[model samples]
Target: MSGQGPMRVLAAMSGGVDSAVAAARLRDAGHDVTGVHLALSAKPATMREGARGCCSVEDSRDARRCADVLDIPFYVWDLAARFREDVVEPFVAEYAAGRTPNPCLRCNEKIKFSAVLERARALGFDAVGTGHYARLSGSATGPTRPVLRRAADPDKDQSYVLGVLRPDQLDGALFPLGDTPKAEVRAEAAARGLVVAEKPDSHDICFIPSGDTRGFLAERIDEAPGEMVDPSGAVVGHHRGVHDFTVGQRHGLGIRRPAPDGRPRYVLGLEPVSRTVRVGPVEDLDVTTLSGADPVWLVDPPSGPLDCVVQVRAHGGTAGATVRVTADGVDVALAEPLRGVAPGQAAVFYRPDGGGDVVLGSATIAATA
Candidate 1:
């Protein structure tokens, strides 16, 4: 919190409890703060018109109210044009290619850190802060400085989704609620009389309000009905589309061949080119190693082999792995076999010291072995 002047800070408020509380904290800390609500896309009529959630018109008003209570200026910036070109389009395209894309990661990378952050800088703001549950630290020397750490409340830590943040972005970023638990943050909001204090956490992607991603994709992408085949290439059933399924998925496969021992068959692979969904027993799904491409380093890249834990997805648990910073990307061989490593998911590396600092950056899941 040092080396910062009495400067302007733009706080990205998502009309959620955490972000509202973050804006209040920045105001209390004596910095000139402004609340910015990013309008992601057009409002859907079925969305109950005034729901104070992200991407909804109601949410923008809630953000304005929080700014009002904190006595800070508030504005709504339309980034839908860039959002479609950057996050939404890429998401649809990736899924069409049979990859399970992480749109939240894309939103953070292209929108929050790149577009919105740039806008803040252009407005003469010193830094842009958000309610993200991550911490940043380093000497305040240059733009390319700082290390990203997990929030104090491990249960609420969001560092995994933020591994894409560059060192320069981290230097100008602040997470006011990083050290506060969700319950405490809510309590502070209520004590301060904020309306969204009791609002539920926004979980689903903002654009797809109904959480029916398969349906959304069906409307957007041309469908090629595929066949469900066993590993031996025997046809089991028909699938609507291979893009709707992922590795280790069991429930929705429509194929009802009972297991010899009364177990359930899980999807083991997706062959997009062959237009087949490969199903097998659970043991066949175990993956002992994963290769990722285009890895970015948060701290300086490690010179040699380093031991750390890796998380393959946002909420996935950590697995023990030996991490080597390769010229192409990070190579991680899991000490224990992991199941369900899907392409296009994030694989984030964490320090073993439990400081919760993200040592390396995010990578696209490339191959599973």
Candidate 2:
């Protein structure tokens, strides 16, 4: 790799400190780097003031300023239509069907790696660089065959959201912040005179900036009043819609009376067709086994039952499990019972090698036992 000539690279700058430093690192490495900001929303430019989300007009401007400072060519590519079709619409539909969907995973699978990488390849770029906190390991001298691994900074590791990327996508991807700590990244940004060095990290779904997911769903999905019953078939209360609730949700039940055992009630199930929300004790949420669908393997699929660590949610803890890959998906037998395992959430698998946590792949949870 040392003797190889300069490679043409396209850096996707999100107008954040992490991406700014990622682009700068590529340029410093003697790669022919160009920065591109993705315009993901069609909202008015004036709406970006003090916006606490990524991809805003202000974020694009910040990216441009960083590119100008780095002395690299910069351009903004509008992807609003593609984003709505691939990520936003599917999110509403999954919620309507009483499933909790991860829009970030969808964006990684469809927009960033697929749409952005494909476009870059066609434009003669050898690889696309991003600021995600995930590591890649492979030979440095030959053709790159990336093996996805967790970031050195465990708190900021983003491998869960990126587990949906395929092997082919990984070959053309570069994550420069994988080995760098967030604090060091910020320090580097400041040293480079980048303006977004002190910007706060954005939280919650970017589309629902208000953080009112239930209210957002209500606007898109029609209100369907239905019965809220206990596990014993006794009517407890009523709900506006099943889409407004998810498995293990406790608040907003509208039930004034406590359970007969003086215990708190939780949402156990949701029937979209009948619009029924089932409430039960906390013990009902414990699941020993779970199955997922539409598996995406970064490497080769396992031949038989494989022991791995399973992560059910983005910010949730991992569990030791024996995974058996099925024809349609994979079945995970947890070593201990897991609570609040919900459908439509990703189940990312990892193996503990001597190196570190290696990402095997991921699938969407479909059922639990």
RMSD to native for every prediction? 2.1, 2.1
Q: List, residue by residue over 55-139, the lDDT tens digit for candidate 2.
A: 8778888899999999999999999999999999999999889888999999988998999999999999988889999988653
The most accurate candidate by lDDT is: 2
Model 2 Cα RMSD, 1 decimal: 2.1
The count of residue-pair clashes in candidate 2 stands at 0
TM-scores of the candidates are 0.94, 0.94
Give the TM-score comparing model 2 with the true structure, all chains together: 0.94
> What lDDT score is found at residue 133 in candidate 2?
93
Question: What is candidate 1's lDDT per residue for 1-369, written digit by digit as tens?
Answer: 345555688999988889999999988888899899998885533342233225776677778898888889999999989999999899998877778888888898889988988998998887888999977776333554677777888888889888876777666677888888899999999999999998878788778776778888989888879998876788888987788888889898888667656878898888788788888889998888888887877767778887887888777657888877777787888989888888888888888775546556667787787
lDDT assessment of candidate 1: 0.81
